[model samples]
Target: MLLHASFPFLKEASYLASIYPQIYLDFGLRIPKPNFHGLMSSVKEILDLAPINEVMINSSGITFAE
Candidate 1:
């Protein structure tokens, strides 16, 4: 299962993904919307618990600017 919109629940999502083999995390554009410091912290938090391979970065490429 994919963890959608997981920024708000980083600890929980990362923990689950770290323990469960079938669970995966999808961090869309949520992490990039913030400033540089925030972006770094967000990534750090995710990596703290979850394995690097279990995390997935997603980009739909469609925005609300239209």
Candidate 2:
């Protein structure tokens, strides 16, 4: 399943994805809207818990001008 704005629930989401192969995470929408530092921190948090293959990068609603 594609999850949106999953930063705050990274731990839970990661655990779910790790045990259930059907679950997948997307770092979209909410991730890209934040500043670079915040984005990196969020991504790091998610990565720390979830496997790399289980997570996908999304640039939705993101603009270079931001």
**Separate clash counts for every candidate:** 0, 0
Q: On residues 1-66, what C-alpha lDDT tens digit does candidate 1 reach at each position?
A: 564537688888999998999888887655545587886778788889988888888765657656
Candidate 1 local lDDT, residue 36: 79
**Model 2: runs farther than 4 Å from truth?**
32-34, 63-66
Q: After superposition, how far is residue 6 of candidate 2 from its true place, in Å?
A: 2.2
lDDT by residue for model 2 (1-66), tens: 657536578778877877888888887756443588877777777788778888987667566675
Query: Per-model C-alpha lDDT, please?
Result: 0.76, 0.73
